[model samples]
Target chain A: MSAVEEMIKERLKNDIDPREFDKPEFQRDPFPLYKRLRDHHPVYHDRFHNRWVITRYWDVDAVFQNSEAYTRGIYEEEGPYKFGSRHVFGPNILEYGRGDRHRWLRNVIAGQFVGQKLNDFLPVIDMIARELIDKFRKDGEVELVTQFSHQFPIRVISNMLGLPREDENMFVGWYQALIAGLGFGGVHLARGIAARNEMWEYLEPLINQRSKNPGEDLLSRIIAAELDGVKMDMDEIKGFVALLLAAGGDTTDKAIANMMYHMMYTRPDQFDRVKATPDLWENVFTEMMRYDPVVHTQGRRTVNEMALYDEVIPKGALVLIYLGAGNRDERVFKDPDTFDAFRDDLHMGRENRSGRYKDGKPGHLGFGMGQHFCMGYAMARQEAVLACAYFANSLKNIRPKFKEHAGIFSPNIDSGGFRSPAELWLEFDPE
Target chain B: MKLRVDYKKCEKAGECYYNHTVLFERTDNGFPKILVEDLTTDALRHEAREAIEVCPTGAISIEE
Candidate 1:
């Protein structure tokens, strides 16, 4: 074996079970394994999947922040969701590009999801949140994930994209199928493909309509958006719209659900604290993200052979940066495991000291760093903050009936993805 | 430690002041007009950074 591969094998022996890749249980509780990997092989390799796993806070953060060493193309591979010729756009348009192209593409979409744009949509999102709560208020129990969590983001995104409510059900199915690929393999893979096709079928006509007669929706805006006087064509527009629905819906849905789960699970006292200080919704959301980042690991392929973690990583090697593990690194966080909702620390950005610090490094790896950091991060944070704040202000007797363990269906650290209590089981007193 | 915002870059998303009213405040113009600054306090710095992340234009930053 090559020297690098040999070192990887040795590291794998110390951490990670061989069955973790395919085992449902491992997917559910991969954190223990992730913790071990961080402890043993901070820069370990997995021969089984041929991926290098970076687990230390500094190492993972470096991978996330360094666009040169760790690139985003490796992570945006065409998965089972790739539809045949039925799709108008090629695979992985926005999520897989490099440098300037990526930045430009991000800007076009960011125009809709970030900054004041989010504020513009707050009223709509609030309406959706209230409508969902109203439906479940009288019921002593509500399955949060299926009934509310899943429903809210779908409607909000669909409306944002100007997709009619008639298409909302189909859109939800597509999102669920695409997101399922992160967890279940076979059937879900097929479902994701079918959903992709269905999405193209649904979006093609919509794209054509927007092309002929544009409106105020995000779809119309992107259709009219320009880059250096070069307008995005129908195929490019479809690709972005599809991507928005998939990436935006899944991440935000899971994040909002995860925030609620963490609030009720780890810090019940904090839940009460939220009620006392509804104004702290923003802080609560930040703490929730810091405590349990939904997108656990982001992958990057090495652009060239380079020295990493006191070892050499060959070019084209897929690198897995363990984001969740980084958030809990004792070297950065004071008490990495404890969830302090009111942690008076700023947990975002490079120079900030919000993470759990052991030695000195910052502990937050919630959003990947650098250029490829989550483009929709601002919007996602807004949705979570508003949603959580609304819940605190309006709902009553909100608590989990049965304990929820880490969900194995979605990717690492997305515990609420699989089946977030079908209902939040709140008696929504609407105070 | 006081939080400083680059009003030029701030789109006034209100994420900073919404979450950290203790250390930061937003002006009517939607920019995070930092209420206070403490360069040494890690707590204040952390909250300031969170505000910075919420800024869509990427305008907010903490200065020691």
Candidate 2:
């Protein structure tokens, strides 16, 4: 925009109130305010929240790419930190910043989630997905959130761990409470910590058994995955399993719901095409990752002074990267608000850590980019795709119960802006 | 062409060595030690690229 045009736009636009973030309407839908922030205050320093908000596409990518300027993960760099001792997850990978410790943790665990190793777990994913769908298939109408969406991934995780099939409900309960405490404080945090401690104690014997006699299960694989004979210690192993259950399970749980919400409600026409071809389910997954990702805000702290939009963010400032805003960024996407599953502009394949694609298209910022990109990217995408395809295929003529939903929102303030339909009711025929 | 390990970029996120042991091996500290740097055939180059693509940090690349 020209200087005169920019001035006019600025004059017409009203300043944003930081309190707007706390409102229910913003919770239900954040894109409007996100647009305003992107256009006017691309690098907004919200005084009320005492944090810098990054909303644009390139800006969010820049923060993810530049490790020199920002630091992610749960622990701080300044103090002497005991790995995962303090957090509810107990010394998982999330606690480490960018360093040798973080790299070592990531290297050992990441291989299990990608390539043939990830594919090895496919039968379990399919079986669990089928089992969950079987529960409500005979009913012809199902409350998807509790009945299918919530139960599916947690069961898959448990089964992968070689847990007894009967103990899944216990894992589910722990997962729910643990997720509640993830970023939320007060009562939720207390419950979450209690669940974690219980889970840790429960895993002690299991870890011991695995050490003595390893098996073909994921838990055994995790125990045995080594680098130059160095391996994850007991605490690290248990912490990772805890992290995986919540981080991998809960986020994927939300992701599956989001895909259904968009397909059944937002774009019923596209749903018709997908139902007709069925292969387009992958496109639906890709579009949902861009259109409205489950993970909206990714936090980073400025480790060095940085310049953005004529303003300098000093070191130690908290930066909230709004990926929800970035996906809808007009500068990067054409017809940014509309959810088009088959759009050519967006990279519609599996995501990679380096956001740059061989096709030269910008992928969704949902999984994030660069160094700290989601480790479970491949597994999450595959699991969601599998679950969605199975749902649409197995349940004959599956569709939303009603045209309207309560809309996606963070259920609680401490939910860390994770948004999805609280309840998804769907009507389908038994196959 | 030879495989180059960008030490600065590689964070030892074991996507390469663990999955593709044919092209790389793990160091004691978990960094990927290149086992086959020399690529003389299209198949070898293909194998090298596959390794490069999976690195979480984009630390590995082919050097001509």
Candidate 3:
């Protein structure tokens, strides 16, 4: 057997059960199973997780759009409603809140991220990407994920929140711990609780200082922001900051790495095309997101018993909206498996077509749709596109180093929900 | 083609203004402002259509 095949087989040995979606093998390549679910059981009830997994594009989009029928249920006392540890208090984080509260928080937060505010962050993103690339430009070979991709977003977010640059390593550690806590089982959950407490302790004082001596950063802006003349309290401010750090840092980090991985390994021809046509970087990033989004699934709850795809999902049942599956659904995408940057059938960015037509294509549900659509969609896009453009413009002969060692394109693992290369080693000539 | 924005439905995603900067500009409050109410040139109309297609909330519309 080939060395890479043997390694993969050894990894898959522990994940023998095909139905276990959380298994490492399933996480590595869930598309085959996703195709099965979509074809045979569109509304399959996962008995293990006790949730209905929606795989079809239309059904997933419907669930996202119909917020009233399927609420986030973020405030519910028990189950998966509580996003973070119970220790954190004040108003629920924007994602967890429902109804008017969600709208109010969303508006307040969304206001800080549009147009000029976003444009202002472009230079900051560009500078960071350049600096990170410069650090390893002469190294000849670099682990892109750990050394660059994972750290860039955290630094940018830290700067935005007015956090000290020297303390970025601390924030990264806290983020890792907190995420570990959010993962499956008790040990990770305990770690998550500890991380939350540590984060709260660290942030409370900073939030207090911002409340009194507010600066020109996002933390200060959020502190001073008001919805209908009611300002957010200290705890709410902390919540927002935590959410920003977590979402902005982790997701953007993974996204940039994923895009690069796709370019270097999965779609080198497209990468060459992008290099030939520099302007296509934007389209490349858009298509990269549509083809293989970082966020694989989002959790929601049915507000009431609703009939969908011939299955009557019960009230208060947890629903896993399989965005990765939806992105590749054949009914929605032509040649869904193929990665096409110039696919005319797909809307590029934060777009949502009213209806699907032969000439008209709806945006992928990567950042989601409707009221709960990702507030950071534009910011993420800008960061990714800029970082990618810089790499494409600056780096020469960039290619995956794993191919020589193991005949594998990428060493990255999907890990079920989020898709990022665990460690992306690439060799590039300095420009 | 006449362009209009449904301000109430607009979440200020900013796709329209960025995609068609010549035809739309952002107000002080960050919402979109139609730079030219009636776009006569085909290029302007094309840009406007692209902007409309990318609006997440479907806030922008072109009237023919």
Candidate 4:
């Protein structure tokens, strides 16, 4: 056997604990551990963390599909706000709500993101991408993540929500603090709470103004949106806006960074193909998401005792559907480890939302499925595709900037749960 | 076989088009359009059933 194949076999044979994911080495490269988990324990429980880590495609997809059996309300019980405050995410946040309330909130916001509404935002997204790229075009080398990827989505989201463009930095800081606070034992919980308060304080007067004098923006639309004559209150609107900032900003930023990382470092050939054919950006983004998604896992609580993969999970148990692992499942994708943009076996468009794989091909679970599928998916896609197309068209001789001696893809760290390089430094010739 | 879609209930999640493209196509605005309103083949029936089951909004149904 080849050296790489032998190394993989040896690593899979090692008895690695699921909790090893907390360790830096495993965090940097978890696919070896994921292989072991998928091969040995598809539904392994991490006793230390007190949660079930599901690794296989079918099991993860099943959890996403059966929302009734496994609800996102788990976030309420074990989330960072469990002990601190009830209003952290607000009562009407789409992620926590279930049944009719969830549907109403999703549909209301969904209208703002679909059809011509989304088309209108494409120019805004393209402009944001060009402006962000312009800032670093002169510099021979740039830290793409912090300088470009991180700021682009937040800017677009700020425009979409009718927020001031100058305050993008503050919003980015708030999102970072809030996401960090969501970590174990509320590491930065106080910071998160303070940020939320600050955001609400800033938004209250603006919301009131919009209510009195509505405009052609998302905030105004929310102020006007009603389901069966039930309008969202200030707190509900605040909650929804907070969720939008956190979800829309963090997820899309990481997605763009992850896609770029994969393109330049992991699969340069695919990157070249995309640069050659601009239309392939959609396929490249879809395949990149399947290969290395930004959001690695989502936590759900079991509503009742359930049996999966010959393992019985008790009621009220915390189950994490590992999207990264499912995306690379051997049973689902041929040579799952390799990143191939033209792979015919995987469903490309809105896979996670539908979970309806064409010809039984099985789609990636980057976005969750069923009732709680990501409401901002279309918006996210538009931003990523536009940004990617811009980069592919504008940059020449794009390549990763390796460290002086380490000879690696420039050392970078992963955030909690989400898998993305903290900083992706790349050298490119401005076209 | 008749394929029915509840337009009011349809969120345009796009399951039908992605799963069974031949049977359903999306409009310019992204809503699903049933191409073969009357699916007569057994193969089409199986595909339609899968689409119905996968629809997050439960907007699609098959009737004999």
Which structure among the candidates has the greatest TM-score? 2
TM-score of chain A of each: 0.84, 0.94, 0.87, 0.88
Name the lDDT value of residue A213 in candidate 4.
Answer: 96
Docking class of 1: incorrect
Flag regions of model 4 displaced more than 4 Å.
A1-18, A75-89, A92-97, A184-187, A357-360, A403-416, B1-3, B6-64
Q: Which stretches of candidate 2 lie over 4 Å from their true place?
A: A1-13, A73-78, A225-230, A412-416, B1-64
Error of 2 at A247 (Å): 0.5
Give DockQ for candidates 1 onward, in order.
Answer: 0.06, 0.09, 0.05, 0.11
Docking class of 2: incorrect
Per-candidate TM equals: 0.76, 0.86, 0.79, 0.80
- Model 1 deviation from the true structure expressed as Cα RMSD, one decimal place: 9.7
Regarding DockQ, does 3 or 4 come out ahead? 4
TM-score of the A chain in model 3: 0.87
Tell me the lDDT of model 4 at A173: 79
**iRMSD value for model 1:** 11.7
Best by DockQ: 4
User: How well is each residue in A42-154 modelled by candidate 2, as lDDT tens digits?
Assistant: 99888999999999999998888775578885466567778766677888878887776676677666767887878899998999898888877889899888888789888
Cα misplacement distance, residue B41 of candidate 3 (Å):
40
- Tell me the spans in candidate 3 whose CA falls farther than 4 Å from its real position: A1-18, A76-95, A349-359, A404-416, B1-64
| Recovered fraction of real interface contacts per model | 0.07, 0.00, 0.00, 0.14
Q: After superposition, how far is residue A99 of candidate 1 from its true place, in Å?
A: 2.9
Ranking by lDDT: 2, 4, 3, 1
Residue pairs clashing in model 2 are A84-A91, A107-B14
Which model is ahead, 3 or 4, in terms of TM-score?
4
